[model samples]
Target: MSEMEVLVEVRGTLGRLTLNRPRALNSLTAEMVRVLDRTLSRWERDPEIACVLVDGAGERGLCAGGDIRAIYDAALVGDPAPKHFWRDEYRLNTRIKRCTKPFVALMDGIVMGGGVGVSAHGSVRVVTERTRIAMPEVGIGFVPDVGGTYLLSRAPGELGTHAALTAGQLDAGDAIRCGLADHFVLSDALGTLVEDLGSASADDVDTLVRRYAQEPPPSVLDTERGWIDECYGADDVAEIVRRLQAAGVESARKAAETISAKSPTAVKVTLRALRNARGLSSLEDCLEQEYRTSCALLSSPDLVEGIRAQVVDKDRDPQWKPALLDEVGPDIVEKFFAPGDDELGLSTVRECDD
Candidate 1:
């Protein structure tokens, strides 16, 4: 009954949560996240709700990301409230990751940043040919948050590191190969699937997912795998950049250039976060670390500068602090991972199998 930007509807025993901001490609808002968190929590305890389906309202599909415009406004005013946005958003992310009942995310198209946060952790992730997934946070001087650290850290070989730093977009096939999505179906089939899921019991839902699912093909970026692994397998961001520059492969060079253009401080901290996250046992642990890093990022010069160039100035030219990657020392990167006394530890949830 509360005013909502996101809509939650219960159809029989199935609860459907739709991201309703189509004009912005369903960009997530703090209010939307709060509504979803409350609704999901209700469904978790309600005996009538057998399962939940998350999808976006528009033809473009699920979501683009968090309302960066809001974050940008806060950054301009030097307001620290944006950190609270991440705190609540991350809580919702972890809740979805650990939901007891089956949660299916219909990832139809243009799923990125916050979109990845909402869908990637679900018990069932369905992708279509229309799906275009990425974590482009680096472009705006931020690391991938919203539980991305947990998912990306677990990716095969060095794919996670490569994707994290490059902010590359992955098509449906690539998404499946990277273990970002669980099932592949045509975009048009999603409606039918949702209808089937709504009337189906737990056993029936499993059968439907399996029946409609098709094996994902080789990724379009498959040829770049060797280069990605060799270059990104380094011990730190600096070395990774060096290796990429040395490789001379077009993909590697392009990736290096992309990193070079970003906030050097963000690159250093993001790489270190991904590397440190590799040892964390669960998504919750990774989210907690990401939350701390994100809060610290709000105060950093790079975040504001990056946003200014890319979003405000529209100049596509950012004067990053610590302009060179080497200037962002290891000590600076390490500070983001240091425990914050006020930070909430990630929930101890059941581990997800990739």
Candidate 2:
């Protein structure tokens, strides 16, 4: 067997998958996504594999996200490769979402962007105190993908809208409260928990998770839910921005400022994606919608410019094409959600009984 960038092993009936690139904080590469998809498909049909455990290597835990550096490089040269990246990555994401066996994700450290895509939709999403979760794609001139629209839309009240626009980070408690995570456990206990799962059956794993899962501590954001609802309740991105600015609450004002720094076009598209996702019936539908938006976004000016300013140029100041939110008209935003070739569509994964 060839050594893999992504390591896979079977312990009893439990299949464990680890993202092995810790140096980059286990940032997901295209190759890794392909390997993961293949490994998962194999396990999906394997009678010996009764459950799955997905986690990150080293101390970081899980993954940070898809390799944006690769995407940025492709865009710089006008390569169409980024589309393939989103295509395969989104397919893998859907596979995880629709997996038949119970899937457990151990999110211990930085879980952001692509990380959220893989773990947040699992059957069991475990968050530890050290977990720092976010969807900070706007800062890089990209809208959130990987079923982010679904998760963000489903978040409590208007919190999803706020998080989408600002790329806000959510702590462990906020993750649980936002429904991004199902359980909270201490970071130190993850090793022992994994060991326990190796010897335990599916029922045993469920029992252990139920017994050991801890309630998340109170979150500062929980207290401000009412305010978030008020500011983000607007029907459109423009209205939401205006409401946040006019609210005059310290948190709302700060959120508006953070959002203002992101690519206006990206923010507008993200808002629309989340809104459209609200009507989606399944996670696959949401991922497909996001795939269309992402494929279209690759050709947009803001994505490249945003990547330049934030990642390549390292100037921390992107001269976003429209700069101002008002400059991104509805017509421009709508183009992102437009249909593309069938190649961008998500493929069906085999469903299993858990």
Candidate 3:
């Protein structure tokens, strides 16, 4: 990858942004986030740029996620770099959600965490068979951020809950069904789609997209909705687990085991964030809530330990401070939602229409 982590250009009316770090799966760093934010801001105001398209450089993925290794390094010594990165990253998410022009995201590969933030909120989200989307933050002792809770809260039935707890990957079918993506084009056709998009007028982008779009395979979540809705509907995580374990479906039982293995605090807090997001009016509100929780995670021991075990050491055995779900009390969860000294202030800065 070049020093320029994000490559920016204009092809006709389409403003193209390519994430340039194939080696790291184009995981977002603070600098990369800032560049995206700046470029999007500039393109939003440019009369010549009628549309914007964002994609990844490599065939590997759009983005793996935010730089966890950087976050882990920052958290080791109480550095505020992670918090700062998230603040700008969430702001960029809000911008994408409210973009005036047709913002297209080619979510053709791995789309998770920060990847979803940049793509899912766009006016046009394109997925391919190669797309593998997830928000596997619980595995790293983190709650979903970048307005993820907002999107997940609105997913059909309790599919969002199932995805959150299990850190499961979502294929193109599941992604479109869960409302994370809008269109499905085959991987082989994506190059032609992009070529057409580059020369097409902004008004014709939709037509061009439809020309290439095809029905995705059946959603796995759709088939399991009956059991997922019933088991994940419970307010309490423990009860949710109990319901999952007793559901008799092998998948549900496996989900229960998966949730049990994740950081207890993250799972509990994530559930709360998702539920709270359901009551919120806009994506900005959810972003604000996420910022709080993300900052709180910075202080929690599990975030560091989880990243160390999963990313640094590759042991995948995170020793959560409060090892069991029962040990994560109300106070612990409440702390995540409490107002901080320095807030992301998405809602406070500008109101977003619901």
Q: Per-residue lDDT tens digits of candidate 2, residues 167-248?
A: 8888898888888998999988888888777777666667787677887877767789987999888767777777888987
- Using TM-score, give the best candidate's number: 3
Clashes of each: 0, 1, 0
Candidates in order, TM-scores: namely 0.94, 0.95, 0.97
Q: Rate the local accuracy (lDDT) of all candidates.
A: 0.84, 0.83, 0.91
For model 1, the superposed segments whose C-alpha errors exceed 4 Å read 1-4, 348-354
Clashing pairs in 1: none
* Cα shift from native, residue 183, model 2 (Å): 0.5
Off by over 4 Å in 3: 1-3, 351-354
Judge candidate 2 against the unseen true structure and give its global Cα lDDT, from 0 to 1.
Answer: 0.83
- Encode model 3's per-residue lDDT on 78-184: one tens digit a residue: 99988889988999999899898899999988999999999999999999999999999999999999888998899999999899989999999999999999999
In angstroms, the error of model 2 at 241 is 2.4
